[model samples]
Target: MAEVATSASSSANSSARSVSLLVVVDPVARRLDGESVRIAKDVLSAGASHTKVCLPDDPEEFARALGRRGSRRPVVIGDDSALLRAVALLHRRRELAGCALSVVPVGSALGLARSLGLPTGAVAAARAVLDGAERRLDLLVDDSDGVVLGTVGIPPVPAPVPVRAEAGSGPQGAASVRPWLRTCQSLVRTLASSRTARTAVAPGTPGPARLRVEVDGVTLVDLDQPVEGVSVTPGAAGVAVVEVRPLSVGAQASPLTASGRTVTVSGAHFRYRADAVVSGPVGTRTWVAREGAWGLTLPAE
Candidate 1:
């Protein structure tokens, strides 16, 4: 009996220490200081039996690195954008639901990751990748074949896409050094204030936009009424909670709310932010909720 117990214990230890990991570090994560990323690498390496590391700079390289993952579990090291890219790639291949994904959040935009119950600290998130539970989570898929693991809001607040540009172009270009547009706007605001003796517009004040919002084919709001914004959030039981808040202040009626598997919005040209990406200026778009569409490894209990 004692010999049998010892053999079982040894087998369990070996299984625990022999986890194979394909650790793909995003370029953005590498661009940051080495301390956080170094800590994550050291932790994963110490725990896993075999760890293959890849530093992918762009979407193509990122996909290729993941494609060559073989049989090892994939552990992504980056912020929310990096995580979303991995999910998007897997979903495009129709392999997201079947594959368990882990994340080690390591960038400035980690709200989505932390909101999904991932560990915030590097060491904790990395360790969770090894000793965590794989939970099947819900996601929103749009008509355009895009996926959203977080909130989707109309009025088009898009996250920055990861792309490389020349030394003086893209987001860090010389043109971005000063807020020239903002300064001009401030001057205009001051002149308008002097002429009209009124304060500048407060934030959250809506502009005149109208939309027809429908959930499960039921119209919640029509174009007759002006709207400030419309939004959809993941809710219980594979349903998305849809709302259209009246942008106008005087017509303070209750915001229209509905929950359904499908939410559609149509009207004047509009765009929506899905996860980290901003989608179209289309006339209309519909999003469908899929239950257990993907798997995310998070801290146990």
Candidate 2:
């Protein structure tokens, strides 16, 4: 039986040597020094016997690449936006339950990543992906097919539109023409553009849209008053935590909380921000909180 034992040993060695890893880097997340890509490749090389690196131009192409690596874990090298894109794709395909999501944050707008306790630097994030433990987390899915992991809200003002102005304007004009300045101007414009409807507002003044919310088939709030925004946490299952802030107070006041698996919201046309993406202005939509939909690696407690 020496021949049979030798053959089995050879097969085991081949199987051990066949472990492969794929690193999906987002072009937008590429660092100034191009070090994020380098670190990702280096980590994968050191951690696995076989590893491949890929740069996806956008979310669609990223999803396509992910589809090709069936059953192989994906390591995303980007900020929260990129992470959200990956989660959305996995959720859409109903593959989230089986895949372990890894992220290496490499952008300024990484609030969600921070919230999840992911490392800010490329090397630390890479090391986490290589050695971190997986934990199941909740994912929020809205009726418009929007997915959110952290917080989602509808700001009072609409998003800004970029405008180009001639150079050599006055100092004030030049200052106003800057991108951040233009964004502020857009916020002001939105506030000025808000229309007041007698039915939608209280007697004193114009206000936010009044919305009706239902949780798990139970009506939590009827059309009581204008609500500044609604926030939900999908992480808490059987508990649909809802927060309502009024425009007068803005996001200052404490939010309302409820518990359920399904939540339905009805109100005037307002854009929805899921994670970081502005999704829709549908008058009504429902959100279902699915438990244990995906796994993520976080810093050890």
User: What lDDT would each prediction earn against the true structure?
Assistant: 0.78, 0.67
Runs off by more than 4 Å, candidate 1? 1-16, 158-206, 249-251
Error of 2 at 190 (Å): 11
Worst 10 residues of 2 by lDDT: 1-10
Candidate 1 steric clashes: 1
Q: lDDT winner among the candidates?
A: 1
- Residues 1-301 of candidate 2 have per-residue lDDT tens digits of 0000011133344443334566777766663225665676666556655556677766677878777766567877777778888888888888888888888887557888988888887777777876778888877778767777876665333333335343545432222367777777788855755643232332223346678888888876667766767777775653456776654553465556777788888876555666666655567878888787789876555
Model 2: CA > 4 A from native: 1-19, 31-33, 156-207, 246-255
TM-score of each prediction? 0.79, 0.74
Locate the minimum summed-lDDT window of 10 residues in model 1: 1-10
**Model 1 lDDT tens row, 1-301:** 0000011133344655667888888887776534787798878877777777887778788899887777888999998989999999999998897789999998778989988999989989988998898999888898889888989887755344332223454333223324665566668866854654342222222365788989999899899988878889888779999888886566566887889999998987766677667666788988999988889999999
